[model samples]
Structures are given as C-alpha cells and as structure tokens.
Target: MKNNDMLKNILVWVVVATILMTVFNHFSTQGQSATSRLDYSDFIDQVHQGQVSQVIIEGQTIRGVYGSGQSFTTYNPGDPGLMGDLLDNRVKITAKPPEQQSVLMQIFISWFPMLLLIGVWIFFMRSMGGGVGGKGGPMSFGKSKARMMTEDQNKVTLDDVAGADEAKQEVGEIVDFLKDPTKYQNLGGSIPRGVLMVGPPGTGKTLLAKAIAGEAKVPFFTISGSDFVEMFVGVGASRVRDMFEQAKAHAPCIIFIDEIDAVGRSRGSGMGGGNDEREQTLNQMLVEMDGFEGNEGIIVIAATNRADVLDPALLRPGRFDRQVTVGLPDIRGREQILKVHMRKVPLAEDVRPSYIARGTPGFSGADLANLVNEAALFAARENDKLVTQKHFEKAKDKILMGVERKSMVMKESERRMTAYHEAGHAIVGYLVPEHDPVYKVSIMPRGRALGVTMYLPEEDSYSYSKRKLESQLSSLYGGRLAEEIIYGEDAVTTGASNDIERATAIARNMVTKWGLSDNLGPLLYEEEDRGGFMGSSRNANVSGEVSKKIDEEIRNLIDRNYERARQILVDNHDKLEIMTECLMKYETIDKYQVDRIMAGEEPGAPKDWIEPDDSIPPAPEVKSSLEEASEKPKEDLIEKDMSNDEVKEPGEPKLH
Candidate 1:
C-alpha cells in the first residue's frame, strides 16, 4: 500500500514538471533570433534599394534577411502596391497566411494556473492521508483513533504488574474467556460485555488491561476517552461506532479506554447542564456495549478515577458487568511493587524493599517506580556503584518533604524563631498521647516553609479516632502557640497562618462532619458536594439556630485545644530551648535527638549519618554570621507559612 502511494506521488510530480516545462517553452523569448526592428518607411526604402534580399510576410507583419546576412522585422502599412514593389525590386517575396490558435489550446493556456493549483492541493491532501472523503482523513473525521497491537507485540504480562492482586484476579477471568470462550459457553455462562477499572491516577489500571491482552494472547486496542469527542456534534458518536466495528472484526480482542471520565460524566450534571458532544459520545458508547447488536467476544475495559460521576446507564449489568477497584497499595502490595521496579537497579545489601514500602504507606505503583528511579539517579550523581539505603532515604525525603533550599539565606533572629516554631510542633506532638510519633525536625528552609516538623504513623489506619483528631488539632496550633509564648502577643508574626487555618478546619470537621462534638449528638451537619451538578442540598435544610450552635461548638473545640497546646509549651519551655539550640547547630534533627531533648539531655549526633565522600567536589561554604551581617542578604526571606505542615486524612502520612 505504501509503495503504491509513493508511486502515485512520483507520477504527480512528473506530470506537474512536464506541464511547467511546456508552458515555459511556449512563451519564452530565448527561441527568437537576434533581429533589429525596422520602421515601416525604412522597410519600404530598404526594399526599394534592394537592401532586403529576401522577405516573408504574414498579414501586416514582415520578416526578411538582408544581402549582408542581417535579419530584421517590421509591420507593413496596408499598401496595395507593396507586393508589386517587392516583386519589381526582385525582393524575393514569400507570403503566408496569418497565424491562428485553436480555442481549446487558448482556454488551456488561460486556465493553466488554476488547474496547477488544484493539482497541488490534491497531491498535498493525498500525502497527508486527508484527501477528500478518504479514510483516516479530515473528511473522514469519524474514524477511530484507537491504536491496535497484535498478540505478539505487547510484552507486558500479569506477572509484571503488582500492588493490585484483587484487581488482577478479577481481570484473570477476562483473560480466560478471551483465550477460550467455549469453556464458559459449555457451562451455560456468558462473559461480561464490559469491565470498569476505577482507581486514583497512577494505580496501574491501564497496565492491568495490557497484561490481560498479553496473557490472553489476543489483539489489543487502546484509546483515550477524549479522543472520541470533538467540536462537531456527531463526530464522537461516529468514532464510537467505528471503534466497535474494528473490535468486531478482530473478535475476542480487548478494547481499553483510559480516563473515561472525560466522556462518561453523568448526563445533565455539568456546570450548565451537560456537553452535547460528550453526551452523544457517551450515548453511542452505551449502545455499542449492550445494544441489540451483540458484540460477542469483544471485551470493553475502561479506567477512570472519578467513577462516581459516570452515568447510571453506562454502569448497568448488561454494559459494565464488573467494577474493579485498584486503590493505593498497602504495605505488602507496596513492597511487591517496589521489588518489581527494583529488579532493574543494582542495590546494596542495606536496601530493603519492605522497609521502604513501610515508610511509603500511600504510594501508588507509578510513585514507587519513580522513587526507585530517583534513588538510582541520586546514587549515579554521587558516583556510587550501587544504590544504597542512604540514596533511597534522600529520594524519599525529596518526595515527601520538598528539596532542601540550602541557597536560601536566613537572618539570625529569623533562624532562631523558625527553630522555636518547629520545636513547638515537635514538643506538642510528642506530649500528645494519641498523635503520631515525631520523625524529624529542621530549621533549614525546604519548599515554602521556613522550617518543618515531620510525623510518621506507626501503621496505616483507615479511620481517625476522636482522641487522635483532638491531638492533631492541638499539634496544629502548637506552632502558633509557641510563637506567641516566646515573642509575646504583639511580637508574634503571621507565620502561623496555615496552622490556624488547618486547626480551625480540623475543629470544624470534628463538630460538623465527624460529629465528635458532644453538642452535635452524632448528627451529620456538613453538606458535601458529591459529584453533583447542583451544589449540596443538605446545607439549605439546616436552620439558623443549628448553624449558630455548630459554629459555637467548632470555636469551643479550637479554644480547648489551643489552651492545651499552650500549657504544654509553657511547662516544657526548657526542653523547647534545648531542641531549638540543637536545630540551630545541626540545622536538622531526627526522632532520637528529639527524644533526648524531651528527656532533658543534650541531643547527640545522628548514628546512621553518612558523611560526604572526600573524592566528590563540595559545594561552596556558607559565610559565618559575622560575614553575613557585614553584607546585605542576597535573597529575601521566604514567608514563614506553615502550608507545608501536611495534616493528611487517615490513609495518608501525617507529615507536619
């Protein structure tokens, strides 16, 4: 087919070139001989004098050669005696009729440019595979954009996928059906028409689909849902039809649509009702899946993070028979995923996948792969032969807490204040009974924060308890309270804006959403907008009195926690100073040092710390306080916003 197209292109260029050459030769002046033009009287004088040896005439125009072998041309006057004079003078007259051109040739010459333009247009269109009404062209915009892969082309199998064992099992049956449909047919069973894999992004839903194709050894067709919809109204519907037709041709093939939510949103639920093109596309998809024309042996698998917003008809048993939830991996699943990715990297003896997985509780499969890649990069940057635990630790820190901003200079007083602020958060979290353990604290600037206090959960918890929530509330305000106690009321800065906001939100959720408040009496007051076109309706039903009570409860919760955090800081002022001084000296401290500080002892150096290699070039040393004080600061101080104080939900790590 490609050879034929190339041949056609070559033939077109030849034809165009031939036409251009013909036109050039027809009107070119290069063919004319060197001839001098003569006036009519001079031609007559020359003829009378016998200077023109020979003459040729066509109507009023004449051409002749003189005795001197010179050529000349002139327009003759309408004189009846000219022919006689030429004859009497022995001018050797040669007469011929006037030249005439055919009507067809004249017309062709006149319209040649337009014709050439049209030919070029057609050639370009054909070259782009977009000729008028041709397949896979602009005129045929309804054609499917799905990429097809034969059985042997896809290399990924189920073994390559990890972190979703249940999802894998659910899809294993699809593979079996594709491999041999008769097994289920003999048992009086029919395979599902469609399967929907719902999960957050990067959970390997698309990878699982490819694995199914590999395991079944069948053709695979993959496309994004957005590819179907276009500005034209019926284009999306047409594409859906064309896609299903393709799948039917390759029977027992799998069709995977990724990010289906783009076209599968619930009908009439968008901002101003719904998108016509998207709705039409969704409607066509529905009809193709479970319509009157049965698509036997063609399994449609779709993936989406926002499954809640999908239309109800699309989720019916006849259409999508199963919904596989490929959520974030737990510890065991994470370890498996890490091991799968780590197989490519050269790891040292201290590299433990399980330990890394435990530390990264809520990471997706893609995130784990990225973590492995980042660790390898760190090892390579240090000219190391193998990726070690230290490299992994640096990569993990970069991912969880933003990269360290060592170039950002800070004032001495501001540094002291940041140390106290982070110390306050650590001390309160340590004292709080139900809070997660404080993992690390730093006075050095990282990300947007001037300082950071990290907390690592002992284990993954699916839900948060009331005591834990209260402890979290206290810890959140710990930064602000510490600032106020140390600097006095008027001297406290706005660095605790994020802490105040987060603490308020936690207290509100406790009163309204969680119903932890005794005054709320286990009632749900908060109205959530759960994938709805119109905003939440529950809030409209609550009375003014109830709303006022909810606000009062939220305020009381915040006030109680605020006082609790303040009192803790006040009692442990000595411990706070010790922790702050350690932070000032080392710029960073781990959990053990924090424990020592809390025990009223001087914190020691980190035990597992690895010093920089002497062979590697070191960064320029930072100037001392005396040198910095003499010169103006090179950079402005970053705002002391506690926005990086990540107080996550139950499943996420609670890094403060």
Candidate 2:
C-alpha cells in the first residue's frame, strides 16, 4: 500500500513538472525581441530630442529603434510630458503591434490542455490499480469488495455477543467443522456449504457470523450485499466469481454477507426486465455456492431480515444448506444482554439486570445496549454518580414511547380526555384473563400520543390460544369504546384512530388468517406468501365472491369483539372512573397503585420509592401530542400457539 501511494505521488509531480515547464517556456521569449536596456534619464532625453526613430508601446514596456538601427527597451511610466514630446516630435512613431507567437509555442499552448487531461486520466487509472501498469483498468471492476481479515486479527467471539444463544449454537457447529473437518468426515458426513441466518433487524446476525470466524481461527471476509452489483452489466457476476475464488484460496475461511436480500431477492419480479444487474448477480452467487469449482473448505454465512423473498434456487439444499432463526431476545436472553452492556456502566445498589430484563420483554440485543447507554446519559444529565433503577426505567420508557415532550401545552378538556382514554385501557387490560399485565399507565405526552399504557408479559409467549387472542382484541378496543361512550360519537376526537386501526387488523387476521371465525372454518383467505411493507407479492387465488365473504366475516369478528369490549367497560364503570381519577392526580402510576385503586383502597407508597434530595430540583413537565393508550403490538395477528406451517404470516398494518 505504501509503494502504491509513493507511485501516485511521483505521477502527480510529473504532471505538475510538465505544466510548469510549458508555462516557463512561454514567458522566457517575451523579452528576447529587445537587444539592449536603456537608462530612464537617457531614454527621456532621447525621447525629448526626438532621436528615437520608431517608438512602440507593448503593455508596461516601451521599445523603440533609433536612426542608427539600434533597438532599446525601457519601463513605460505614464508621463503625459513624454507622450506630448513624442507627439510633438512626430519621428515616424507608432505603437508596437501585438507580438505574434512562434509556431512551436502556439502548438504547445493548444495541446497543453489535452496533455494535462491525459495525465490526470493516467494518474487516476494508476491509483485505481494500486500502482502504475497494474491490472486495474475496466477489468478490475470485477474484483470483490470484501474486506479480508485473518482469524488472529478478529477479536469477536461468542462471548462478545449476547441474546442470540440459539443462533450461536447453530453456527458454532460450522466453526468446529472448519477447525477439524476430519471429525465430521470420519463419520461419513459432509459439512453444509452455506448457512443462512434469518431474523429481524438488530438481532445480532452479523455478530454471530463474526463469532464463528473467531472460533474457527480462519480467515474472515466481510461484504455487504449491495457491494456485489454495479451500474454496468456483468459486473456483479464477475465479483461473485472473484469472491469465491479468493475464498477457495484461503481454505477454511468464512465469508459473511449482510442484508443479503438486496441481491438474493427473487428474479423476474422486478419492474425492470429480467436481465437486470441484480438478477445476474443472484444467478452467479447460486452457481458459486455449489458449482463444480470444489470449494472444500469455504463456508458461506449470510444474514437477512427478509428471508421470505429469497429465491428458491439460492436457498436449496446444496446452496444454503442450513437455516437458523435469530429472533427477539426472551427474558433470560435479555438479562444476559443487559449484563453484557452493564459492564461499563456504574450502577447503584438498587439496579438489577433481572428487573430491567423483566420490564423489557421483547427488546432486541441492540435495543438493550441502547437502553444501557441511555441510562448512563440520564445519570450524566442529573450529575449522578451512578445509574439507578429509576434511570433504567426512564430509559426503557424513552426507548418504547419516546422522549417525554413536557413543554407542550394541553387544554383542560384534552387532558381529561387523555386521562379517560388511558383509564379505559387500564381497566380492560386488568379485567381481561390471559392478557399481559399493564406495567404502567400515564397521561404524559410522549412521541405521537397524549397518553400511554405499557404492558409487560411475565414470560415470552410463543403461541396464543383463541381465548387469549379474543381478549387481546377486546383490550385493543377499550380506548376507542370509552371515547364513543363518554364523549358521544359526534364529540369524539381522532385520538382513537390508531386504536381502531390495530383492532381492525387483529380482527381481520383472526378471520382470514387464524380461521377463528366459524364461517371461514380454518382457511387462509389471504395470500400466505406475502412480503413486507417494502414490497408486495402476487395476489392470492380466490374468487371474487369468496373475497367478499372474507371481508364480511372480518367485520363480524370486529363487531363481536367491539361489543365485548364495550360490555366489559360498562360492567366496570366505577373502576374506570376511579383509575381515571388516580391518573389525573398522579399523571403516572404503576401496576401496584392500579391494583390498590381497583381494590377500593388508598394505597401507601412502595418501599423502594425514594424522595428526591432537597438540593436537587425536579424536571419540568412538557405537554405533547396525543399518545395511544396501548403499546404498539409487534405482530398484527395473535398466533402464539400456532406452528410456522399452520399459521399464515400477516403483513404489518398501521402501527398504533
């Protein structure tokens, strides 16, 4: 690399030297026409006496020939007296015509620009190739953009990553295989050519791949999916070939490609024609993974969030032989992740990773790291020596809801409405069986909501029962139902818009996807192979009449659940009013206070509640926009109990 840099510097100097020489030669001959220099006094006297035969002015120099055929030059000082004397003498004086350039100088000037351009082009070509006369022209475009690193240089290991235990276990076997291929080969087994990691964003997929590379003690090559393709045709294919070839040379190496959906998406479905650069790239990747090139010790690892859109050919048995899922961290996984992130943070005695993990049920590994960082930031803002449980709680809330917008002003009527809306949700969630417990309820404005109610499940739930799904749908409708009942339908604000959207989605999925409706009878009316909001899939093959019936059934499910929610609120009107009063008084309350208020008792403060020191002032409150009364659901449908094959994936609807 140093040699390449030195060569580039030399090329730059060469071009600079050429330009300087051309400039110097052009000005060198400017004064050659005059043979001698005259003193100012003598020149003035000669000019006054009219001894000069022919006087000419060229720019700042005055040149003239005397009657004896002698030419001399002197500086031209604009003296009116000299001009007047010259005009009075009228000694065949004339202004010197502009100098005509010699043919050699004219040619050099005309060609200088083209030569400079050529020099620049050569310099750029050399720089691209890493040295002069290197193999870096248009052909070099095919080189892969992967950054290669030896195992000794990689510091990442399974210990460095947290919250992705299952993914580590799956990829760890590959590391073992790489370390000693004979262990598996002795048993008449062959290692998989590739491993595909599927997960949501920020689930530590790439981190897991790095761990495998570290564990195996082999070369690691990393590249992004977008790096494989370019504007020109055939470049992507060439890059894939080059990458595989390099991987083969460093046998027992690991190649990791992140966000592989960019290039591995299904071909022939794009708006552009089938022969686009991306499709060609995908085809080349397929061939290189399992082609005749015999990649004995090469193991490819790829990570993508959108695994559904990948082509079947690329995911077949021989290509991506094994698939692993890295999902959101469960409670235990979250606790471990918290511990990993908390190593650098100074914590108070009250701070507990288990408590924070319990509160953050569905947080990803990256989210946990951010939570820790935010807690530290909150401590720094308050000039605290250590982060406490309260700081962590505040950080988690900030991550889920958003920074509290305390400065926004709210009308008295709006505050009351928000209070009632949140109270309604709390009442329904508390009363519903199999529903997650409401962790906290508050009317403070956050993000886009004027108020919010948070729920934290005791454990990670993989499946849901029909009763649980119905109860969840009812809870979702609580806020909107309260708005309609208390304010009258005409006076109801748009605060329930997000709630209505979520309720409609859950109801639709129950009917069309979960087949909970008796009318649908365990049938998937919607397309099972659907993409996310970023893209769409082909329409499901259903008759128009069947589609109409599906919509009708969906409405029926929503109406039934809506009535169920309204009745729940009606039966607990007194409890709703009490909770609303408590919310208005406190502006925030926890589950314990909520339970106490429901039991018709004035509750004492918790043992852990600490009073702020008198020397420190409290933060001021800011009003913000209307917030939803419920936390946003991660998935639209409640398919907790169903297996992957039995349940249809629902496209995410509008977030509430």
**Which candidate comes out best when scored by lDDT?**
1
Off by over 4 Å in 2: 1-139, 185-188, 270-274, 528-552, 603-656
Q: Residue 87: error of model 2 in Å?
A: 47
TM-score of each: 0.78, 0.74
- Model 2, range 526-599, lDDT digits (tens) per residue? 65456456454333677988888878987877787779889988888777777877776677888898889778
Q: What TM-score number comes out for model 2?
A: 0.74
Q: List the residue pairs that clash in candidate 1.
A: none
Question: Candidate 1 residues 190-214, lDDT tens each?
Answer: 9888899999899999999999999
lDDT against true structure, model 2: 0.82
Model 2 Cα shift for residue 117 (angstroms): 6.4
